[model samples]
Target: MSDEQQVGIVLVSHSGPVAESVVELARGLAAGGVTAPVAPAGGLPNGGLGTSAELIGRAAASVDRGAGVAVLVDLGSAVLTVKSMLADGDELPENTRLVDAPFVEGAVAAVVTASAGGDLAAVEAAASEAYGYRKT
Candidate 1:
């Protein structure tokens, strides 16, 4: 993909089986013409904490190009897990980014921002800002 094209959004959550929910949300965004990939963290029952981060990192690496990536998580545990994975020197691509996005609202905002062709930075900012809008 070109540098200007939206690459992908990674949703990191402690919620089990993140792919289904994340993909559904992505489909909603796609219906609005946003084609960015959505990668959800977390794994099945008995899976470890960092499973989601690993999955997200893999998805981010496959994006090839674009405005980079935006990562949104469900809670503090998910956030911490992602941070630890990145700090462990997993070697994510240069454009990948992690943001502290509020659970539901942040996901919605991130999806909308990304779908609108907004850059990763913009999407991250939107997700972060959404967290402060009403303080869920």
Candidate 2:
């Protein structure tokens, strides 16, 4: 990764506040504060409850700084929205990876890993591992 940028992350949720809060919380979890860009694409563009492909696509592209991005989403439709957006024509950076994991947990993991200078694959792996987390 370039010294100018580490891997970035995009958080997608149905509620704008939910996604924004996750980003805030994840930034705090970073060892020395978040070094990578983290963008939240949540809720409808009108501020209603929903997700928008255009917003998500913009968020992902905004965070990407040549190191690629890891997108963590909440709910099934958020995934579908992003997928459809990507398929529709908004081409993301080649290194972008859509990670399937628990939203809050995955966002925190991904942000921390990215802050630590991990590459796109490393960040995605960190997020994906959250799927197996147990609080027992």
Candidate 3:
């Protein structure tokens, strides 16, 4: 990926202090030889209700500046929160895409795929594949 084409992965959850959980999962993926930047959502002191989306956007922007970004969020309110934030027409970059991947499995798969040097398409595909591995 180009210096301006940084790829970002987010693990969003309703649970407060999601960053810790995200780090744990990221660590697991890393142990398997996957390396990618993983950002968590929720429980920041000043973060608003839509903090997850905001954090995702910030992380993406940090890497790509104005390039397109991809974000993956967990279940429950996180989905709606992210959707609402993105739908508000805030100045998100043209390539920015906020994808709602399956909670646990998708996040893990996305992190793994990203860590393996997978591109945006590969990361998205891995997230979809994660659903297939869901335990019923």
Best by lDDT: 2
Q: How accurate is candidate 3 locally (lDDT)?
A: 0.61
lDDT of 1 at 26: 57
- Pairs clashing within candidate 3: 35-115, 68-95
Q: Which candidate leads the pack in TM-score?
A: 2
Error of 2 at 47 (Å): 0.4
- How big is the RMSD of model 3? 3.4
Tens digits of lDDT, candidate 1, 56-117: 66767765365677766666666676677667765567666777767666777777777777
Off by over 4 Å in 3: 1-6, 44-53, 63-68, 91-93, 134-136
Better of 1 and 2 by TM-score: 2
Q: What is the C-alpha RMSD of each candidate to the true structure, in Å?
A: 3.3, 1.6, 3.4
Q: In candidate 1, residue 119 scores what lDDT?
A: 79
Cα TM-score per model: 0.75, 0.91, 0.71
lDDT, candidate 1, equals 0.66
Candidate 2, 1-136: lDDT as tens digits: 4566789799999999999998888888765767889999989999998988777878988998888888888887898877766666646766777887889889989988888888888888888999898999
**Candidate 2, pairs of clashing residues:** none
